[model samples]
Target: MVNAQQYIESSFPKHIYRIFAIGKNLEGHLDLSEYPNLVEVRLGNNPLLTSLSLGPSPRPYLTAIGFRGSGITNFSFLANLPNIHMLVLVNHTQEHQAKIVRDINQVHQCKDQEIEKIKQQIIQLQQQIQSLKTCENSNRNQNSPPNLSSERNNDTS
Candidate 1:
């Protein structure tokens, strides 16, 4: 059961791109600050892991992260990985999954509402454009000169 401190002490290659620390019984915070080139991390089944320290360096290229059966409760660590596209949280209890789902649904609902509002604003802008076109045409017609031949015949009287 190697802990986080032991893992950090180990002189692992800095250029290693992938790490699979599944079931390692890692505890405390696992710091990956040394591995600047790390692209993927899989820490599944590490039941003792409570936190993760991604160091101060920005992992601009990191794309995937997964964790399962860990003691993690705070998800703020995800904010550090701006480019992450895939996140897997497996083996969570049913209640935990439900809570996560609920939070996701709330975010979805808020996005949906914003989308609807934008759609309505687009529709209103289209209507305003049509009204302007109508007004422009009416103004053009009102400003146009009358028939010159009709004025000539009236002058002959």
Candidate 2:
């Protein structure tokens, strides 16, 4: 059961790629900016952790992140890691999971609505373009003079 002070006191190698601090008592923020090559991080079972801060800079190589059984409530730190593909949030209570799911669904719904609005705007622009083409065709027909050969035949008849 490593406490926050012990974990912070320990020095990690610069080239370390993966970290598994399970059951460790981590508190406040955990900055891993020193490990530029880090790829996978698993910090589950840390009930003392309230918030996690990946780093001041972006972690381009980070792909997998897990935080099961932790007391973390805010996940806004994930927005910085664009390459993350796997996220684990298991071991939480059923009620917590339900709330998280509801929040995710709301965000998904807003995104879907925004996409539909953009699609409608595109359709409206296409219709406007078609109407302009039709108007231009009508104007060209009205402005052009009648054929001279047909007029001459009419006069002779």
Candidate 3:
């Protein structure tokens, strides 16, 4: 796996978005920091790899990050990935678990803003429909029963 780093360092691809490494050890994980084009990376079932740093890339396209059964302890490395939206931190202590959830919620306020916009749209539409119904009912009630004089004029026309 270390040799792969030498190969990657020599020639790096610029179009790759997703990378899946199976049965790869911690030695291979070092190359990820060098891959500037990586968006989605899956390095599951690696027993040796514990701590993960997001590294120097802006990580703008990086969204969902999953770490299941990696035996990781410190989650401070996540602070580097500022644009991360959805994160799954499995097999962590209660304190670390709570911190991940809290930090993510603080970073993005989209959930709250979306709910507020929906509420406002609903209220505005409801008021418009109510006004229409009021106008229709008022017109119906004000119109007297069909008069014979109006009926004769309609028949002549």
State in Å the error of residue 83, model 2. 10
Top candidate, metric TM-score: 2
Looking at candidate 3, what is the lDDT of residue 106? Answer: 54
Residue pairs in collision within model 2: none
Query: Candidate 2 residues 43-112, lDDT tens each?
Result: 8989877777776676768999898988788775665565677878998878877776676566557667
What lDDT score belongs to each candidate, Candidate 1 first?
A: 0.77, 0.77, 0.61
| Angstrom error at residue 28, model 3 | 8.6
lDDT of 3 by residue, 20-128 (tens): 5534553333345655566676655555555566575557776656665554555655555656766665566778788777765654555567789999999999999
Candidate 1 ranges with C-alpha deviation above 4 Å: 8-11, 94-157
* lDDT string, candidate 1, 1-157, tens digits: 6676577547357788888777777887777877888789888888788888778766777789888888776665555565777777888887877775566566557667989999999999999999999999999999999989999999999
Q: Global CA lDDT of candidate 3, please?
A: 0.61
| Ten residues in sequence with the least summed lDDT for candidate 1 | 73-82
Model 3 vs truth, CA RMSD: 8.4
